[model samples]
Target chain A: MNATLTLTKLDVLRVRRNTRYLILAIAMPAVLYIAVGNSTKQTSGVEFKAYYMLAMATYGAFAGALMNNAARISTERKTGWTRQLQLTPLPGGGYVFSKIVASLVTTIPSVVVVFVLGGTVFHVHMDAWKWVVIALVLWLTSMVFVSLAVAIGYRFDPDATQPAVMLVFFPMAILGGLWFPLEGTLEKIGKWFPTYQAHKLGTDIISTGRISMESVGIIAGWAVVFAALAVVSYRSAQEQ
Target chain B: MSPDTRTPNGAVVEFENVSKTFASPKGPVHAVNGLSMSMQAGQTIAFLGPNGAGKSTSLNMLLGLSRPDSGRVALFGGSASDAIKRGMVGAMLQSGGLMSEVTVREQVQLWAKLHPRPIPVAEALKRANIADLADRRVDKLSGGQQQRVQFAMAIIGDSPLIVLDEPTTGMDVENRQAFWATMRERALEGKTVLFATHYLDEADQFAERVIVINKGRLLADGTAAQIKASAGAKRLSFRLPGVADADLYRLPNLVHVERQADVVRLQTSDSDATLYALLDAGYRPADIEIQALGLEQAFLAITAEDNNHGAGAGAGTGIGNLEAAR
Candidate 1:
């Protein structure tokens, strides 16, 4: 337990110290939210600012799990940092847990940026309970994609993993209603994706102001499957 | 059983009939073939071999990075797994194995966290002689400096055993000497060190025992003097006066003799005995020099002789052609 905490702290420090990426992670999603949200003049029943704000929040959470996690892991493995960690007394579980914690930490700032911008610019209305629920759903959704990113990163070398992560991430973002709401043909396809389940559960809880057991079940199922796969793939990679 | 047998202090590391085979596209390549040897604690043992001699494979097994196909590898009278958990072993592999973005101090502290009780970060940096470079990023540092940081990470826990695989590969002559001094200091402090290097002179300077491997087999294992005595051939060179260079082969105990221009070089095992026999045979020539064989010569003699015998055995079969191809 001590080893795990130490490793997790180091992982957080690494992510925190990388200033350029941290800036980009926060700026990209919030900038997208503001630019797109203001360009639309119509209140359009659902406030444009609130809708894009929620979408970008989900985007930030997804990026933390997918792009940021994958890149960091693949680069570390390629540079032999993973092997150095393996040589230590730290258990394999500790290393993976540290990565998850680091991803979660990175996701938090982006979440705050989205919420603050939403409240100030869009004047979006949500009670304290609703905000808390949205935050919880966002945190839980981050875990599923983070596990998938880790699995891909461990299974492939940096050169291959980066492109592979981008390939998977962009499709999920588009299909899961980041760019626009999943409608018509895309909505049918999006329902099958883990990201879709994550966004669906998140949007349902935030907009409906109620937690649905069905959405929770779907998100929970995806998290379990991805986390299990990540663990197995990581163990196999360590043996290699 | 005697206390020595049950808890041996001499052999800090022992490999009993250890073997490792890796799968290749062609077939299974035997990296290590049933090798057994032991080294006393506080001794600096050099593992010398040519490329593909399974030096890295054997080191990996000892470090618990890979398991042997058969037999056992024990460290401090315990298995590799047990030794690893005890934090009794430190390693500097061929790869520097450091995070590129992290500063020197951060990397040291991260690894230091692995031990239950570890040396302070300042002390480990000071020991590696890289205290000044503590704030420098790993990728920003020179290869030698990065190597120093890696060395620091390895030794931060004060592990009793240090395994260095070609640790001085990217280092300059001065840095190499400095690194050797550090390693010598560690050994002097009663820490066992297993260093694998293709550089025989470096091994000769520091290793108390030299283990030479060739084609996945242990060719020789002993002290420098003992290995030289067993496998090293003495060389007697002289400028022949009017005698044909080819005629030097007639000298007794001369396994092979070579003539270049007016000088004849005779390689034999017994330099003193051969010198006397040569003088008694009325072969007294100007500038006769009987030189003691160095570690390089000893390594070549053992591995070359082994290959020769192996080739000789496989001559009748088509495998001899494959061996020659290799």
Candidate 2:
């Protein structure tokens, strides 16, 4: 087997066994979907239930990916496991790539639970292709936050990562309009954020059959920037 | 020996005039001076040093975790990084790096998969003497068992060169013995082994060659017997009721004298001459006793020198003084 594949498998195995991560990624989103998503009525010429469901699902996927990756990386950094891996044939790039893949794998449960709840209970109506597009867009855009999570892992000690994740994640979740509907100046600010773009892309696909090229471009741009930062941080992390 | 004195072949590890300095809160600290040494394939070498004696710094260079400020560190005729990429070296660092949540088996298996041709997981566990604890979580294990797990991780690869730093730190007497037995088994398979240890007796019992360092400078490079041969003084004591301490101190090459009741003890550079002088002084040879110092005392006496190697000239002079003092 390829080295990266082996690493990915090991990472997946470890991530699956982490109960705290599973709860954080899946249960929190499920509870949020049930609590806030139940009372929403139609708004903005779209069913409010569907809009809030898509927004929360996108938030769950993005937050799950970032927090899981950051927690793993920061723990490894604290334990000096990163330095131990450096003594092996495993390349730095391979280790980071494995973390990204693990983050993506772990976040799937969050997205699935949200979608299942939304479709079964709320009766979110959409074509098969629309559903696939929304899921795919959300999953793909979550990669942007994966890199940002990696940067956080490299920049801070393990103890600081939990607060750092909360500090960065909640504001983005709020400003990105995952909770309440964006309006006025808040919506204007949220327009430039990747989380807002991702949620809009998912909800837009459900409302309208067409996809936005501008949103795709913006998400890709953020992914590239985060990827660059991750690389820089990983290289200089130990020096600091 | 000088760097130029190294053998041309079969030298699996080499350090040529390597020096490293680190910037500390107190100023620049020289962790390793211009030190040179090499180990042949199948050689088990022990690096002996006191605290802050550059042992860990040198091992870090060999493991490619840190680069030397000057000169080169090579393994298998290539740079340390190249050798590491080729999966030729396995190491057990002093810091405990195992994941607390993972079982011993899972951790060892993960590390085994990282190498190109790792040994069997079962075999690694058995050799490291942790097979019974394989199913146990790392955090639940005692400190000695965790050290054994770390050892298992290091040897799982079956690499040609094995480097360990203070590998037996938390081990009990039984575990320590088992650890060295496993190390001996690996060496018998023609693997090159280098370990840094504070236990001079462990070095004497296990290592074929010992390298002593102090104040970031190379103090002595020889076998245990050879290092012991370099000790400054040996004690020659006798139950002489009438021999005065001043008379024993007057013996040639005598460094110090002690008197306790009816016995007189003389510390001398040349025990034979001192004994003959004492015999000539009318003390019968039957009452005299000479005691050879162990490696521990010899190590302490050698490294306690005030030889500070400041410039490039200092290291050579310090080592030279070491040899002369011997």
Candidate 3:
């Protein structure tokens, strides 16, 4: 356990040092929110600033969950770092366990950064408990992408993982209404993505004090599918 | 009785009829086939084999990186994973990878913290000769520099059993010397060291025991001199003009028969028997000379014999070709 934690710490430190992760998962969302926070637009029955704040926070968490881990996991396997760890005192599943823990830890910074920007500079207000709940909802639902990252990392090589992540990233960010509020055909399609549902869960909490079963069901369904993919790919990679 | 008789007291490593077959488009490749061997504590063993001769596959099974198809690979009288979880083994694999984005110091430090009882990180770094590159990012270093960093990580745990696969592959002469010196220090401390290397001379000088495998089976296992002896210890040459190839091939214990015109060279397990057979045949060959074979020549002779004899055919011959010196 100590060894796994040490690996976890090292992994977190490595992610923190990655400039690409910072630019994509942390800076981009915060910058985008600041540029569009004060628009005269309403989304999901909440103030434009508050809704956009939730969307950007979800954006940060979602992107943070996917980008760093996918590239790092694929690269580690290719380089034999995973095999190196297996020869250690660390137990089975220790490498993947540490990676997941590190991914969770690294995503915290983005969530906090976006939330603070929204609550302070953008003047979006909410109850203390509401802030905590919304943050938890967005962060927890982003785990779908964490599992997806693991799947992609195991399925592709390091060079391919970048394009693979980008393939998922653009569709989720745009179709999920993270960059802007979606309506008509876009909303109908985007409502099914975990990212869109997670953002809706947060906005509906602020506006209606409740989230729909459909939103919860969509996130949970995607979570199961991605988690299954992660397990299958992880096992296959180990066998090889 | 003693947790299986094969694991005698103080056996640091053991392989019992283990086999592993990998399936490819070409068909199933038997990477390891019923290979069995064991090592005692404090012995420095060199594992030698040709390319695709199951050296890496066996190492992987021993390190618990992959499972054997049949039988068992035991480390310290238990499973490989068990021994590893106890931090009883430290290995530097040929394909084992180093972490990027971390400095050499940080990388070695992380390795030390992962084991049960690790030596000081500074001691490991200095011994591996990477102390000067401590702050340099691992991915930014040269291939040789990265190999040194791996060496440091392998020794950081100070485990009782150390396994190194081609530990000095990218090293210069001086660095190779230093690397062997540190390995000698480890051996002197009563640790069991198993290494596979391409430098046959290093094995001749460093290994207290040499084990050679070919085509997924134990070909030869003994001291370097003993293996040389097994593969016809001496080379005998004589100018026997007009000597029939059949006549030379008839020599007792003949390992190889080579002829260059009137000059006949015979590698024989027993030089005396081979020479007397020629003389006994009423042939007084002029300028008779017998020369001892080096480990390299002996290795070539033995493995070549096996290759010509076929994979399973060499089972009776035990014959390690060690073409790439394992």
Q: Point out where model 2 deviates above 4 Å.
A: A238-240, B1-8, B233-269, B272-289, B306-326
Q: TM-score for each prediction?
A: 0.90, 0.88, 0.90
For candidate 3, lDDT tens digit of each residue in A121-239? 87877788888888888878878898999999999999999999999888988888888899999999999888889999999888877878999999999999999999999989887
Model 1 regions more than 4 Å off = A39-45, B1-10, B241-259, B272-285, B312-326
Each candidate's clash count: 0, 0, 2
* Poorest lDDT segment (10 consecutive residues) of candidate 2 chain B: B309-318
In order of lDDT, best first, we have 3, 2, 1
True contacts kept of each: 0.47, 0.47, 0.78
Task: Summarize candidate 1's per-residue lDDT along B1-326 as a digit string, tens digits.
Answer: 12332234567789999999999997788889999988777778999876777888998888777889999998778777677677777888875467756788988988888875688999899888899999988778988888888889778878878888888777788878878888888888888889998677898889998998877778888888888788646888888667754445555666456778878787777767777766777776788898888887766666666766785333232223224423
Candidate 1 docking band: medium
Worst 10 residues of 1 chain B by lDDT: B313-322
Clashing pairs in 3: B49-B326, B303-B321
- In model 3, the Cα lDDT at residue A222 comes to 94
| Better candidate number, 1 or 3, judged by DockQ | 3
Error of 2 at B94 (Å): 1.0
The residue-level lDDT of candidate 2 at B247 comes to 74
After TM-score superposition, the amount by which residue A230's alpha carbon in candidate 1 deviates from its true location, in angstroms, is: 1.4
Worst 10 residues of 3 chain A by lDDT: A38-47
